[model samples]
Target: MARSPQRLSGTPDDQTSPIPGRVTAPALRRGLDILELFLDSSEGLRVPEMTAALGIPRASTHELVGALVDRGYLQPKPGSAGQFVLGVKTFQLGGAYERSLDIVEAGREAARAVAAECGETVQIVVRDERVVVYIVRIDSTHSVRLVSDVGSRLPAHCTAGGKVLLASLSPEELATLFPDDTSLLPMTTRSIDTVERLNRELAETRERGWGEEYCESNQDVACVAAPVRNPRGECVAAMSISIPTIRWQDDKRADYVALVSTGARELSTRLGARL
Candidate 1:
């Protein structure tokens, strides 16, 4: 019978080992590193393997693993005494994380339904400090839909959804997010070019309860967006529809605005917002 290979004692300065001195909790850091190790492993890990890979003392490794087991973060592998794997609690936490996201449950269905209804690309965006991130996207059947995909980031001043999200922030938050007025970088000739212009646009967006972008993020695309709110009336996201400029008509702007605003409202209601 072939024997299993022994776990090698990794060097202290090795790339895999978490560097010390940055955090105050050594034991907690070790525990987190141990958990991260499984991201690279397909099988359960043993105490000796953890100790060797992390360069932690055997007793400390055992104690940390034992504590994790007691907390239900780790469990002994089935039929393998001394080997451990992530526990049900870890999966439970992951599920909770997924469920707690308002967009995951409410925003996705709305985006899909709206895209199908309008035959245009629908997007869900969230503001990340100074930029807007596309969290979800539902594509249109048309061949000329916006090329931006989920996880794409763009300057807040240049996109309809970004403007909607930025409009939701308080004055202080806005000041903090854009400490330097020059940070509002224009993406195209039509994009908001200065902080003063962007602020005026955002104020108008707040008043109208919607935002519009034409040839801003993309020269060939035009977008309309509205804000989505959480239960506490906090704006959590923005939902938008993008259409090719060549296919856009001045007469259809109202209809497009109505569709996006309705989608945003429905998603916000699903997220427990009163409106």
Candidate 2:
């Protein structure tokens, strides 16, 4: 057997080291560096401008720029050939990150207050494609409570929070998410099982300004949810209160709706939404 080559170690930043301690991809680092250059510039940059600023060859700069544009991290400036700016995908990523931070802080406070008042489990969720992902959960004081934890993903058509988030989407967007031939999967017998029914429920949810589900996601649970809007009035998340079916009274449905809606409004306000 041949002996393995001896390793040479040095600090990652040591310029004179033959082999640095940390490994990195030069192209990736350079691509990021190019993006950072935009921080100091309000106007878009051309290939030549980026090359001069990064002190790299023009061909390398062009390749990086093309890759970024292809991945939607950058876009050509409107009416300006060869000039590029950060793309909508970049804004979306930044916004999602910022909203997540705000949601965790504001959502917890709102959910705590609601759970305390109603003695029911409260949760905050955001839509990811066709599913709703739980981001915040406040367990009920009762011994029997919802078992779904943070990061759980559920069908968007099977839960109150999911419905509320779905209701926020435009008709065209909804159509795209659920094509005519698509089947709506169910977690329980009571769950919505058809795209048509889901659409009708979403319409009602929009009309009533909230969403409600009974024995849908869980055969023994009922839930009510309202949309949490951002400063721009966009529904960024849904806040919900879940109750065990044994404790879910039809007479108290209005009260449950009111409480969850109020909780959602409070969370939205905390996130700088006007309403």
Candidate 3:
């Protein structure tokens, strides 16, 4: 009689069974695990310490560390033997990753979301010396709205977004920008026209974590803005919402402030900021 074929035993989910077409390298996995251990370690780690932390064989840990050192992914700590830290290669990779982030696109999405929430015109701007340059704008659905467009430049002391950006600068930097305590140019009668007054408003902006302009940039327009920060916690831009003066309500100022602040925080988060 013909013999029956042998039967396979374990299910695909069994630990001992290898899945079909699934490629894995134990050595590479172990090597990566070793690198990850250093993330939580402030000081350099020795091969033995890594081996203990990762539960890899001491010999394997040595081999992996040697390979990483040779590849410039790790380097020996200064004046320390057999202890390694992340290498210059990691810094280079980090810079590349940061450079790859596109602030304009991120701001555009953030502006759209905020505009949708508040039903007002939203804008994103960056500081240019004593001025703020608009980079993104989302128009309000209302028939009447602020008409500022992308690429438009405005006095830093006269607009909410501009004030927010200016507030991010140091006192010395502000002094350098203004150069003197002379009165600034006015966009309208309500605009802040003196360095002293602008400084006071900027202080208020910093204290409240947002900025506001009432008939400053335009007689018939008012605005609120908040700062957008990057991963390094540096203010990179300002996000603002403009309201027609006729529609502006003092009672609703708090609501506008909350909306613009939330939008700025969202944009900051998208830029990799922790908060």
Question: Which parts of model 3 are misplaced by more than 4 Å?
Answer: 1-85, 181-183
lDDT of 2 by residue, 1-275 (tens): 11112223232122343455755566776687678777556688888887776667899999999999999999999999888889888788768756666678789999999999999999999999989999999999999888988999999899999999999999999889888635588899998987889999999999999999999999999999999998678999999999999999999999989999999999888886766
**Per-residue lDDT over 84-193 for candidate 1, one digit per residue giving the tens place of the 0 to 100 score:** 98988887876675468667657789998999889999999998888989999999889877787789999977999999999988888888777676777878888887
Which runs of model 1 end up more than 4 angstroms from their true locations?
Answer: 1-102
The CA lDDT of each predicted structure is 0.84, 0.85, 0.85
lDDT digits (tens) for residues 89-114 of candidate 3: 87787688789899999999999999
Estimate the lDDT of model 3. 0.85
**Order of candidate numbers by lDDT, starting with the best:** 2, 3, 1
Worst 10 residues of 1 by lDDT: 1-10
* C-alpha TM-scores of all predictions: 0.63, 0.64, 0.74
Which is better, 1 or 3, measured by TM-score?
3
After superposition, the stretches of candidate 2 with alpha carbons farther than 4 Å from their true spots are 1-101
Clashing pairs in 2: none
Among these predicted structures, which one has the highest TM-score? 3
